[model samples]
Target chain A: MTRIKSDEPTGWFMIFPALAFVGTLILYPAVNSFTLSLHRIYMGLPALGEPFVGIDNYLHLLQDPVARQAFGVTFGFVILSTILEIILGLGIALVIHEHFKGRGWVRAAVLVPWAIPTVVASQMWRFIFNDQYGLANLVLFGDQVSLYVPWLAYPGYAFLAIVFADVWKTASFAGLLILAGLQVIPEDCYDAARIDGANAWQRFWHVTLPLLKPALLTALLFRTIDAFRVFDLVFVMTQGGPGDATQVIQFYGYKTLFTEGQVGYGTSISMAVFATIFILSLFYIRTVGSSLLKRETI
Target chain B: MRYTSKQAWLLGGILLSVMGSLFPFFWFVITSIKSQVRVEAIPPTWFPDWNFSFYQTVFTDHHFLRYIGNSLMVAGSTTVVALILGVPAAYALVRVRMAGKVWILGGLLTVSMFPQIVIVGPVWQMLSTMGGLNTHWGLVLPYVGLTLPLAIWILATFFKELPTELEEAARVDGCTTVQTMLKVMAPLAAPGIFTAAILTFIYAWNEFFLALLLLTDPVKQTLPVGIALFQGEFTMPWGEIAAASVLATLPLVVIVLVFQKGIVSGLSAGAVKS
Candidate 1:
């Protein structure tokens, strides 16, 4: 095979346009956010210029009760949603992997929630959870029941509603990825396992689980990061309401920056989010190693 | 071939899952057509009095059509821009065999994962300073950046699978690198381009946070932000909101149905890999 001569200049030239756009649009804003977090800039009318305040923003975050509550809400949301998505997604993936009539239609149906925008999905759920005219009360209680519980108006129920919505929207995404992984496994392995007198549970534990690790990790990683940074759904559904019951970090940052005009403080929250996501990604990559990036056969 | 208990269980589970996945959308469609009186009625009207008044209100009173135009313009532009920049970069990563390629790919993936909130503050400030706020281009610029990483990843996977002999043949036939890439390689990679375009357009269309922040002017808002902020002065208009939600989601549903195979492969490529 005749090797194309490795031309560094040509490679650099070809890559320049993408690098330039990414650098200006993504990298610069990221660096600017980091810099702004260290300053005291008020976005209020008659804008006060940024002044270097170094770590004060971080300290303020530590003392802010609302911020602390947001962190807790975010943690719970991420953990609960990710776990639920994994279990539900795995079951769906396993079922869809079977040879069934109308399987193609089922797969397409599953992608609908994921296909719809988060805002729309949240609105759909909000209507269902409405206190007065909501389907939840009408159906769960008698049709004539006057007593109603506004699900989104209370803290605990509001939080549960958000979790329920998140899981419903994303579990199919997890299922699709895991289904792709399931498709790649050789049928002969299962045949061989059955020949060796292995039961269904034993085969799944030994063969399926081991081979499915990469896909499982990939699904978990994407879902965790996404759940942590959730904004549009929560924003549209509750606006982190019921006295900051469901405020996640992203929503907190939005309020600080856009609503309160505290640029420095908002950037601090944003920076914290970035750091947390970076650490999580590093953990996944380190544990799963390079195989996460390997191209899987369809 | 008698049906066994296990097969029955599996079939039942599949049926339940399908219903669970699709019921929300069915409800959404039903809500869109309900009358205001019915929408607010207690013992929520299971069977709505067939009414299209909310749809009329959304189209005529709210200027919902303009929001759809804005969304289409932004998402369409973002898809085009991301592809133009991403294709060459993906080609280089695949065929150039550059050093530190793995790190470069990893860095791009990390950028895709950057929480939008982190970037929104700086991006807002930059656009404000440049007098780009409340404009279509302002939103399109950031969306291009956000969608580029995924586009490049998907395109790169496709490019990597292309045989090098095609490139070599084009080169030997007196084609420059640019000519070979544009004339020979791109045509062969059509399916990949289609996949990338669909996904990129969806992301831009569905994005809400930045749209809410930058396009505060009602006329400039996209569908997601527009429908979200459509709360009435005295009361929440569930009927109008539901009608508008259906309209906003219609384009995506159409896309999913028509291009299910491409969308599925594209999603798997971005998530799992090839």
Candidate 2:
């Protein structure tokens, strides 16, 4: 606010607490995780001793079929969930963006799921999909007791159950993001499209879509990054169960690190997770930075 | 006719979206209120019998109130610390001339994008080493760290948007920077700070991963961790778990309902900004 080239010491002083907290807790530990990844350490077998085993854990991660399956699952989960969220989110954004009575209430309604804790949402879905007396079964089979699907027990359905829960929870978030994007588009663009004899779908496809690209990309990137680190859903709903079908990478890391106490191997998985997100965020930053730079030049 | 059909389609979509968003939590709330027999009924009770027995049981038997208190303390402190740190950092990042400002923000962006798995291992170890495990401060320590990036981002955008006149006038009044900041800018930035605090509070309240790792003792665990682990202690504490979930999530739901606009703006601004 003060355009007056104020003293820089106060700037540093004001900023120290946040920097200190992040540095000590996040940046330092992140680096520590890297160093920890280099050594082979087991919590249960301390006598085996902490041995420096460079790249062995990485190699082990590569060979482990469970890790492979986890990645594959993570890949599927990200793709399916992000696609569904974007589609549903677009529908939501389009609907809410229109001038409607009680729009605030509707928007708030959309945010309810986003507001609930992931653990809570996961439990809610688990109950919803419960085989015995679950809402899913009751709604589907009614009094007929035989057809209750053990949704989380079956591998294919189990995966879908988590994805469905995810979509239910987060579609609203994407919707809000897209709505923010939608609010910025000039009304004249649509008016012009209508003047050119463009029908609703045609105008949406031609004009609305192209302009909404950045927003869609923003939503997509955020969703993708979040979906990559999905742990609470898998942990609560499925626990990567019924043949490890839902074992996303983060859950795998958790089990290995905390459950099994293989700290070194676990940290490698953590590194992989970090690397994947890092690369993704770099791509996002490039696109975002280029746009900002473009604005600067203009 | 075409216009009416379009409006109908819009209405249909709007109804579907709202129901889809609200139905799951609404179901949980209903379940939380259902009697034990009614909860287990095959044809699940469509309407609650207005039973809050499960709520009574959880608070009494499961010490659910402790978890809630723990969550409140952790989330509250996390919000305070995040804002205390974030507001000035954001102010500096926005207003003050600092070198390597771009890199600091770039680093903040990277931190925001970081998956918890990346930092969980060492954070766990560090907490364990410091005997911070199972302590509220232990959990708050990392919570503050993880939330700072988004807090700063949101606050920076808010600070950038404030009109310059008040700040300029304060400066011209010969008030020192700190005095002007504390007395002037902060009150003006209250709305932004509140938004940031709400977002941070909700995040810390709902954060399960670090809490799960750092706070293992039942007495020390926050609400999310408690709710997540609610099932293991009983054969099928569905009713109780539902009750706990409802209890755990009620504050957040209220937060969303009341400050929906602020939360949405903060989230989108943080996500979309530099």
DockQ of each: 0.68, 0.76
lDDT of 2 at B68: 86
Residue A53's lDDT in candidate 1: 98
After superposition, the stretches of candidate 2 with alpha carbons farther than 4 Å from their true spots are: A288-298, B232-234
lDDT per residue (tens digit) for residues A1-298 in model 2? 3464688999999888789999999999999999999999999798999999999999999999999999999999999999999999999999988988998888888888998999999999999999886888888888887888889999999999999999998999998888888887789989999999999899999988877777788898889999999999998888899889999999999999999999999999999999998788779767866754654452
User: Residue-wise lDDT of candidate 1 within B1-274, one digit each (tens)?
Assistant: 3358769878887887888888876776777788888888777777878899999999898898999999999999999999999998998888775688888888899898888888887788889999989999999999998899999999998887788898898888888777878999999999999999999999999999889998989888999998888878789988888899888888888888887778777788766662
Name the candidate that leads on lDDT: 2
Question: In candidate 2, what are the lDDT values of residues B135-239, reduced to their tens digit?
Answer: 999989989999999899888888888887887788888877787778888898888889999989989989999999888888898888988887646368899
What overall lDDT, based on C-alpha atoms, would model 2 receive against the true structure?
Answer: 0.88
What TM-scores result for chain A when each predicted structure is judged separately against the true chain A? 0.93, 0.94
Q: Per-residue lDDT of A1-298 in model 1, one digit per residue for the tens?
A: 3345557678889888887887788888999999999999887655567779999999999899888999999999999999999988988889888898877777777788889989989999998899987877877885756678889999999999999999999998998888888988899989999999998789999989878888888899899999999998788889998889999989998999888989899899999989999999889877665554343332
Q: How far is B109's C-alpha from truth in model 1 (Å)?
A: 0.6
